[model samples]
Target: MSDSVPMTPECYARLQEELKNRIKVDRPKVVQDIAEARSHGDLSENAEYDAAKDRQAHIEGRIAELNDKLARAEVIDPKSINTDKIVFGATVTLFDTDSDNEVVYQIVGEDEADIKQGKISVTSPVGKALIGHTLDDEVRINVPSGTRIYEVTEIEYK
Candidate 1:
């Protein structure tokens, strides 16, 4: 199954930068580390060699994954979004119906989610429930813990 996730232009640019860094700086360094480790001793008992090989594999896999995501990315500028309704890339401020606490979240792409920064992935349960909703709408989201209700209070693009 394939679903396209919209990413901001800034997120896309960051992905490109990461891909370039991994391919140009990280890949060669790992390969060289593996080569040097191999020169130290036999592979049967070489921890450094094994670790380097594992790191190399992980780096290559991430590079390929990033490339795939970049190829499929639909870049949208967050600043261009102008809707009172919640949508991808919108910063939503909500009043928790259950707790009566205000919360703000930026709906972002999967790779950009950081709860500490108040950015939630568009695919998250709460984010999904909030999408297409406008101010004064009550949103009920089913989370792993339980159901939570939030009232939409504000939406911003930045």
Candidate 2:
């Protein structure tokens, strides 16, 4: 069976854009570099040629990876989700009982996870605990710091 990775529509679009750039712009640039290095003479002592080849290999590997991910991507759109309980793509607001803090987080795909942007991966500890939870529900999570309790304050999809 083939493996499929879940991704938000925005993340899937970003991957497509990167793949297009790699094929259209970066690929040709690497080819031109290799050609230029080859014209510089003896291959036995051609450091430039060796470097170009290494770069070419790296670029090709990235292209292959991007293509594979795009081929197996499952795009989940936030706008189409309608659920009262927390699930993938749900933006949840929680009131931390520990430090008396309120924070917002959106459960997103692993590729789209960025703590600075308030997007957490579904497999993360906090995200996993929030799954299937509803507003006004209390959730307990164990972190490296310690165990803490949080009350689900809100849930929105956008």
Candidate with the greatest lDDT versus the true structure: 2
- Model 1, 1-158: lDDT tens per residue? 15565898888999999999999999999999999999998999999999999999999999989988998898877789887788899999999988889999999999898999999999988888999999999889999989998899988897
Per-residue lDDT of candidate 2, residues 91-138 (tens digit)? 999999988999999999888999999999999999899999998999
Error in Å for residue 94 of model 1: 0.6
TM-score of each: 0.92, 0.91
Write down the TM-score for model 1: 0.92
User: Which consecutive 10 residues in model 2 have the weakest lDDT in total?
Assistant: 1-10
Question: What does the lDDT come to for candidate 2?
Answer: 0.93
User: Residue 32's C-alpha lDDT in candidate 2?
Assistant: 98
- Steric clash pairs (candidate 2): none
